[model samples]
Target: MSDTTTVGPDTAGIGRTRTPTPFRRLLAVETRKLFDTRSGKIMTAVMVVLTVGAIAGRGLYAGPRLEVLIGTAGLSLGTLLPVLGILTVTGEWSHRTALTTFTLEPRRGRVLAAKCLPPLIAAVAASAFAILVAVPVTAAVSAVRHVPADWDLTPVALLGWTAANVLVVAMGLALGMLLLNAPAAIVICLSAPALWSAVARIGSVGETLAGWLDLNTTAGPLMEGHMTGGDVARLAASVSFWIVVPLATGTARVIRKEIG
Candidate 1:
């Protein structure tokens, strides 16, 4: 004899319980986490340091030339900004705080999105901050260098750089989610480009591998506004790799693995 019973939608097994979508939940948590930490404070401090340094360095060293000062200032701080991007997403996993995050959210995808959004937002904010600080610095430098106040804040350049920063941050987030190991992900994100560049410089398999490796030669044109046909193809392939593969791999892990 078989007993058959049908349960209402609300009475379904725990597995069938409707959950908050991962996107909104993750975004809130990620943003909250950024503001609650010493790292966030450190990032703020770095920005201030760059602002002051740009003003002083251009004024004292570069004869206060606006373009020279702005370009030099940007070169100094640009690399660290990307590092900040990497840390934002990787910090949770590195600190093992993701356990708490996952337990609360239960939806892995939402948590991942939340983790990503803050850093991406921060990158845009950084770009604007750079422009703001540069404005005053450019004036100071122009005064020092006796140059005309012909400072150019190319809108296209600003927007392009900001977008590039956001994309790189997103790439870091994707890598973090995929690796689930903070140090490893950070190393890969940082080193991958360097390694590819070095290999590409050599005239061997490295050159071939360079073209195949995404995020180095591939992403350069996308950011720099000089993408050729080969560059565009490589960049597309690289973007696809980061956007698709890491997400797929990470989502599977989040769904199947124990949260804590």
Candidate 2:
């Protein structure tokens, strides 16, 4: 009354083992995932468009000051870069691919760590892009204005700029991982700076909290190449709050969360 099929060697191999995916490959895949979805593509396109637009707008309106030109693009990059990091970390959960991802690479920590590299790399790349674009824009504007461009940029300043972007992106990644929800994480990521700014204007306590915790203030002197011993202490405190806490909690959650 029933049909049955018996499978042998050709049908299955019970003792087969497969090589694990390399960490490098995991990083590569994560990078590709950045452009694999609609939101990702749109965000990426917007970042490119805005960066170029900011550089062009500043170059046309103001004289060619290298720091000013780089800072112009940083204004947009500072906001959007974290958003990109948020999307990168949350995309898996938002798209419901976490199960499959964890199934393939059971070491969730490695996967998560690999996921973070792209954003950090993008940070460095973005700063470099801004600097490179500034060079051409600086030359063009200087030629037009017939004035020498400011070549006062130092290696410390460049490192500080890149570090600040990386820190912001890391905050995004940490928040995204901690929340595991794209919309909520993005909203918080965007709202947080505004909230801190408003609070910083409240009173002495607010100023003290912001001075220690708000990256906007802590990172300012560093970007301006005037980082001092006190700035270092403030920057360290800000980094601990913005990056370490969320990332630590998020990693723990990812390690133990059961996938359906």
lDDT value for candidate 2?
0.89
Error of 1 at 245 (Å): 2.4
Residue-wise lDDT of candidate 2 within 13-84, one digit each (tens)?
666776888999999999888767788788878888888889978988888888888999998999999999
Model 2: residues with Cα > 4 Å off, grouped in runs: 1-18
lDDT of 1 by residue, 1-260 (tens): 76988766784576786666557656776687776788777776877687667667666765644445555545534555555656776676678776877777776666666666777787788767766776776676667667766555456656665666666677776776677666787687767777778788889787877785656557656545565788778766776787568867876775676635
Q: Per-residue error at 142 for model 2, in Å?
A: 1.3
Which pairs clash (backbone N, Cα, C closer than 3 Å) in model 1? 22-110, 26-114, 27-114, 64-141
The parts of candidate 1 lying over 4 Å away from their true place are 1-26, 51-78, 149-153, 211-216
Show pairs that collide, candidate 2. none
Candidate 2, position 22, lDDT: 96
| Candidate 1 accuracy as TM-score | 0.76
Backbone collision tally, model 1: 4
**Quality of model 1 by C-alpha lDDT:** 0.67
